[model samples]
Target: MTAAEPNRGLIHFSPRSGWMNDPNGLLHYRGTYHFYFQHAPGSLVWDTMHWGHATSPDLVRWTEQPIALDPAIHPGDLWSGGGVVDLRNTSGLKSGDHDPIVVFSGTQGVRMFYSLDGGFTFTPYDGGRVIAQPSGRESRDPKVVWHEPTGQWAMVVWSDADGNGVDFFVSPDLLQWERTSRYAAGWFFECPDFTPMDLDGETVWVLRDARGSYVVGAFDGRTFTTAWTSPQTITTNPGAAGSDYYAAQSFDNVDRTVTMAWQGGNHGATWTGNASFPVEQELVGTPDGPRVLSRPVDEIRTLRHDTQSWPEATFSAGTHVLGEGCTAELEIAGASRACTLRIRGCFDVPVAPDETLRLLVDRGQLAVFSGLDYRCLNVDLDRRAAGDEIALVTDGPLRVSSLVLHQLRP
Candidate 1:
């Protein structure tokens, strides 16, 4: 049998069939944002990998395209990597005057792929494997970017194959790469991202991984020097570590950095894996030093239909049907003890009295974000509990202000 089709009204993204993981090769080219992912088309479980392709005119609605790269074309499984638009013929693979899109993907070692016809198709580079000898068994997920200051390309690759660390590489023409530096950190696993953003007034770089923990530092095109790092990994889901949200990456070709994560795999369906909602990231200064802060992009509000707003409400112990596939943006002021939100047979969250939570419930799955600290969570509900009703249980009376519930379109 073929893969099961995804449930409509799920705010996030999932392939029509098969398995998907990691947001790879996210590039904005020719006015449309191209999203490539790690997909195993044959089954719902993760096995071999292929670069699954999709396009979005806006970040909300997505359209699937043909799979870009297959294991047959490349020697190894196509793992997690990113892409860039070659303004110049940096890789010398540009088909015509228009800029070519370069994609870096891997399994054992990193290989280069370029799409001369926008991002619809890709061809392996003649140079073959750029990094022939990876340091570790889990050394994959290459995050590459253009270092404009040095007029070169830089890559940060994660490797648990050696230990928990990342290897830094620099390239001049996007074909040949040179190892520049290596860094070992706490819980630095797969899906590495190096982003440069302005903090206060100074420019600081953020080094992050799938772990959700990030390090603040300075990058000089070749070397990255760390200044500070968060003590705890900022989970895409706060309390639920094993939840689907994994291997998230930041987007390029935008004014601000936006990120998306792989939701999870095999939720009793023919298809597996989905993406988390995109979030905008920034570096904020704290007493310790600098910290990375993230919030859902404002554009998602555009998808809000049949919006219901309440200036003030009290939830003692009652079940209220918000809407099907709805996003609940809530602010609870005065505090007391604890409160729990039950949606469908899932969407369960025990929040503090003073906490503000944004809960998105769709497709028998729930994604919760608490405060600006932004520890996120995604949980699947029982198919039997699939409904529009939400029951809020509280120890005492809770006052909510400016609570808005917006129904998401399928």
Candidate 2:
């Protein structure tokens, strides 16, 4: 991999070719995990979107699959939405040997489709029927979750009503949906995610938007209510050209909370975008309330090769070298000053000796994380090489509780 063709990532999931963005319909079906995305196979730019597919046994290693949804055959641009595996056959769309997988997408309204052959192909429901029409304004990006207590499935769809809000629709069989309630707020926008998680041994729901802004709340199968007062951000804003982590979604049919987002910084001659490293989500108690926190999936340990560790380290204002390899994982605990991470010029974060920081670097991908912030970035080789700059830099003094670095393998 070089500057001419896009650098194939060592950890991040990149398109084999063409353009892609926004991980859609994340689901664990059968034995493998499926990652569907908004894809345009014809060019290196965003066009009419189709659902591109990839599968992985573990979250770390992925294999690109054939195109799952084509605009010419799937109708419309396919847009973006969520997917689920109907193990109970609630949709009654199952046939042959495999269980049915239900997916949703559309604009100004929501549409349903089912896959009977284990997600290799999808058939439109009721000939592409709009299950629920728009009420106050436009609607799109439907994310569905099953409520075992209520024995129903609920969809969280982005809506333009009341300035910005999400409409909750309940369905029994995934074939029919009834608008039950709407949660309106200024932070609600595209790619809304509604999920239930365990917080302090209590089950609570988390409502999040595309930009990683989220609020902790409670849901009763249909309606959602929260006392957050205002939304808190789980990630930094994706306004810079190099920092691009957006539209993250968790996988359905999985027992644990795991998520992946679109890293929107990669732009090369061959392909355009890639998926962020998968992260496990958890709810930690804060002074204000329960807040969402994310960390890289533990499965990433499979890629570690040559490794080194230090119990603790301190540094003065100077440059620290990190060897010749560009792809590796750097773990730092209890930082004291801002550190500029040199890897395609993607990682540059401040540490306060109050949190744990982990930085993952690959061919053209970079992800930085702590308890408070999560971010990912992509780059092309033409712009900057990974080893061209120093690995760590501090302006003043710094102290770390612990530090480790590992040489990652492709």
Candidate 3:
């Protein structure tokens, strides 16, 4: 079954046609941010993969650009990888002062592509394939980042082939990579990303897996030591169990760590998959342990159309209408009991203590994000629930410190 019309998203990014998954080559180049994804252009279901491109001046508003890389340029279907701005002509791929954008993906081996035109288009470098395929197991998804201390480029690729967590490789010129270190901990699989973020005014590195689970630790260019591990299922809400946020990646060249993911809502659409709204990633020290906290970018407020405000309201254990099916932000300081926020019976968001939650409702889909742990839930409904009415029900005492709802514009 295929959707008759393409489902449009207000803040999330979705292609106009075909299938998309695993945000790839997220880069902040020049003055604009580029978003590339694993896309199959002709069909809704996953097929031959190509790199789909989109750009945004700010993280909130995105405009779809032309396809960046296609399978015809490589030996195999274009898989997951990353992009980097070859500043200082490190890779010697830069033709002019624009500092060419270099992208890496795994087809037969680690393939390299460079764009001289500011990431608008790309061409195969060195006959397309660079590093040969790793022996034994098939590994893809190379996440490249600049290692400042070592003054070189570093990449982390994951494969479950040989009791390994992630393989770390270092390249001096962005073309030749040498294996430096290997990390094996927990159940790590595909789409490896390593980023450094500030924790309590201290800088720490975070290693993220394809499952959306991440390990906070320290990386000295090559080796990584895990300080804390947070599973993707850290959501305290039962309703959030349905969220499928996978293959999330972060971009470089930004002041703060910004991460996005494929929402993984493949509910029989003619064109499926969408990017989760960009979140500001930071480390939060909890009583239990050190964990990562993500908050929606403030630019999201720019999409707010109509507005409704309620300050410190008390509700019983039943359905309480808040507002309409739009974007809503709620702050819960102290809730004596557990509660679920719903809209037309489509969204069921569990409220946590002293946390901010953002809910976006567009047509038949509901996306909820918790600011406390960065837990997000995206669910597609069978029927369109229309109206400007939201329901909040709880079994025990429910007291909200603040509640604000806004209608989102296209």
Candidate 4:
């Protein structure tokens, strides 16, 4: 079968046949990356949930695989959740040797399945044990991870106890789980992911909020007591610029972490249909704080075509065409404070207000409009102060840097 098209400068990996949400089971096994996601096999609308599978040799180019687990196998229906590879076989299901185990959550309870002959097919362990079912009906979407120090398993599940928060649980042998505590109960904390990262110098817990914000905290295994001092928001969407991106999940790939999310929502134009891209998350030190910036992984460096760099350019309002599928960066100089840089393309025009700016894989025409209502779409800046500024820089294969322009305001 032919592989799916590459995700431009962004690594795209959503279901080619249906709706996708809440990336789950992001694990690296044996030398390949395997991840599961909540999927419905016919539309962009969320209906029934099944585990959509995909594998990547490099974290960027992905090959869509068969459905990992189907909810129809059980009676209740499969919900959104995560998966992990049991390296040591802590469940004690083997006869002569240990095997890799896959643990996930369903509507009934948390379930366990293992692949003895390799990860080709999986069978439930102990007839799919129900690890924990507190209150019995309101718990779903489990995020499980194995704690190295404790040598036990830790899980975070979605609950409605305090208005849609994540409940904590610990299991010694992947069977009996005890409810430990509760974390931030926001409006709707759908997919809760906790990973330890070395930030600056201290180890911090990165928590992704489905509603909007991405929070980092100091976690101590038992509880995430410390609130995130530096709160950052994720604002990029893959399928369409205006579509809603939600339920993002991440996994460690040894050298870097890769993330995926649901592409569209209950409402939107639904242009590209339903799909998503895998983004390599990087911790960049911004003027504001330690922010997470995502881009298509460096493996895509193999796909570069005709790179260009313009050292500098004066700001005169006119249409500037940089070839299709290009990467551009602009550094601003001689600015009183901040200026507005607008990117016009096939997607909605994205305006960035500042000194340093970056745009990736943008196609369509570029134009500078005037007036608050955008009355003049083809106007040029007049007599803009000129200085010895590195206005525009483009390296071959379409990488541009240091382009400066002012935002059109009311």
Candidate 5:
């Protein structure tokens, strides 16, 4: 299939004109996936933020839509938040029988916007009135989810009284809300999401941390109690260990629950760009606990140009070259001392004599070094070996396979 095929590999959606960040207002309504984000049409800065909208039937192919929420519509700028479909049409009835309600956060307060003629055009409800705002605290990044058990709506807002964290509120009707509790201090928790996941026939709440990492816990609508001692780090591209990945969130559509992140330069950096790709997230069991593993979605099979496989090969302290768009595998043995096998280079860095053999890959350079404590080889030269193996993508060109020199200990 061609690159522009409908079912192409991991696809990405950014503003057609400018800077985009933080996937916001993710909703699946009327058999379509709709999402919005913080977009600045002119510059790369975050000052002038607007809601950029896009829709997709399948998660792989996205169709861009017009600006959903403009800053000019409201007095102040648009901020990060989420959207939900009002299946019941609780707001009011329109000519089409029902409308989609979008709850978003802005500079002044949390406001609701609705679309009568489908999700194409949206206007503020109740004369664009502000619903809720803290007295002394500034609240933004509102993530709303409907609680099925209590039959109530819950929202988590990014606020600061002691420090930057999330505050919880409950609403019987979407309009009026009551403050219930607060999730104590942490780093700037921008996009907080609470969803129920099935694990071993038990339900667990997944909380997404925008700035740092995501947490899996048990939540009872009013309060969230963390079940895990530590939070899991969410990265954009699990295939490569680059520093340009950050700020990912989950999109729970009808078909699947996938996650996406902003793939670009780091914050306060000048070299930021766009995403390499978007992958599907799956929950798998590990020895430690349940972890998230990202892989190119099944649609990616259409993007395969050609497939090449290397059966069995052994190399020792030598340099080899290969053409582009190729996959190669190597198995080494009989090295008494830890040694390095450099690909596309001639230098063989010494691996510690006692450590296990290591595999490293730079941009296009690939190598294998020995030793567990090979600090230089593991840290500086081979940056891919820093994280857990299951979380890493092994099918791509950046995959590194390692082998120990000695025989099995059994």
Candidate 6:
């Protein structure tokens, strides 16, 4: 069925066949990046769960590998989870050949899986023992991070225990886990991701749910407390469009915060979803509060071929054509509220003066990434062949400080 699907993205990663959701087991091992996800290989929709994998040396080019975990071979539903590299053999599961990789997933309780050959394959740890059990009900998606300050591993898993929250757990060896505390909020749903970012030289832990709603706080290995009890959203009114950016997670063992998310609307005739181009995240202070900003990884530049730029210009309300190509990367700065750029007649992306919106047109997929904020929008262009001419329409006369378009190399 891989018969040259025209709708497939030029740079985005998608499964060869079937459905994919919520990236899992994301980590960097040695020289390659291992990307794992919730996959249904037999159908175009969510069905049987399996761990679909791909490896990348630069995050731009991906090579699909065999299924890493299957429901038939691995126990439980093989739900969404995260992994970590036990570099010090703290788990004692290492065989001296490779560092042990441990991932967690399940429904009511968390199950553990380990890989000896790096992230290429996995085996059920302790014959499928519930490493971390759910507190109340409706639990899934466990994200783990190593706490350097405490010299232990910390985890955050979404659960309905006491009505919507994440259960915090700490493990010394990855084999045994101890439930530390439960951080509950009605807004927290599923697919919880945790990252400790340096904000002005101080480390602050950010916990974000599937919908891009995040809370900034402090973590002392045992508990997470935040003065910002309300919450700040990276993306709003998402899921109202075709595919909301969801289930974003940062890579393990990376020097900086790098994230990737599932673009739910990116479905072709063969594949049901695609990964939003990888982004490097930074914690910055905004007038609202401390927010996380994201931009496409610089490695995406290697895919650029013909580059065009307008350093400064004034534009009227009309379609300003830039290039003639179906696949291209765009960086438009000097956003004006009077501008609402339309992409290929399929998406109406709004522009704010403080935001630099990046539009990525990949055949039938138009992904809009708001650089300053983590807001993202994916327009489903699967039905119509996207317009080859990339253009921006202004609501009124606007001043643009910068505009650049790079045609993606096939």
> What are the per-residue Cα lDDT tens digits for candidate 3 across 1-410?
22234345655778878888889999897779899999898987778898999999988778888888987755555899888887778987767658888888984357788889899878887777557344326677888999888899988877655665777888889888888778876567678888888887877888877766667788888788875543443233322111357787898788888888876664344577788778777778878667777677777778777787767878777787876654445444555566777776655678766666666665444555665545555555435454546777887667877777777765
Instruction: Report the Cα lDDT for candidate 2.
Output: 0.81
Ranking by lDDT: 6, 2, 3, 1, 5, 4
Give one digit per residue, the lDDT tens place, for model 5 in 79-171. 777777767655444556545656566654777777775566778767777776743367777778777678877887777768766778888
Query: What are the clashing pairs of model 2?
Result: 335-353
Candidate 2 residue lDDT tens string, 288-321: 7777788889888988987877667887887666
Cα lDDT of model 4 by residue, 235-295, tens digit: 5322232244666677743546666665443222231223334556655566656666665
Worst 10 residues of 2 by lDDT: 381-390
Better by TM-score, candidate 5 or 4:
4
The stretch of ten residues in a row with the least summed lDDT in candidate 3 is 233-242
Q: Judged by lDDT, which candidate is best?
A: 6
What's the residue-level lDDT of 339 in candidate 2?
63
Error of 2 at 63 (Å): 1.2
TM-score, every prediction = 0.88, 0.91, 0.88, 0.73, 0.69, 0.92
* Model 5 poorest ten-residue lDDT run: 387-396
User: How many clashes show up per model?
Assistant: 5, 1, 2, 25, 2, 0
User: What's the residue-level lDDT of 127 in candidate 1?
Assistant: 45
Computed on alpha carbons, the lDDT of every model, listed in order, comes to: 0.72, 0.81, 0.73, 0.53, 0.53, 0.82
- Per-residue lDDT for 101 in model 5? 56
- Point to the candidate with the largest TM-score: 6
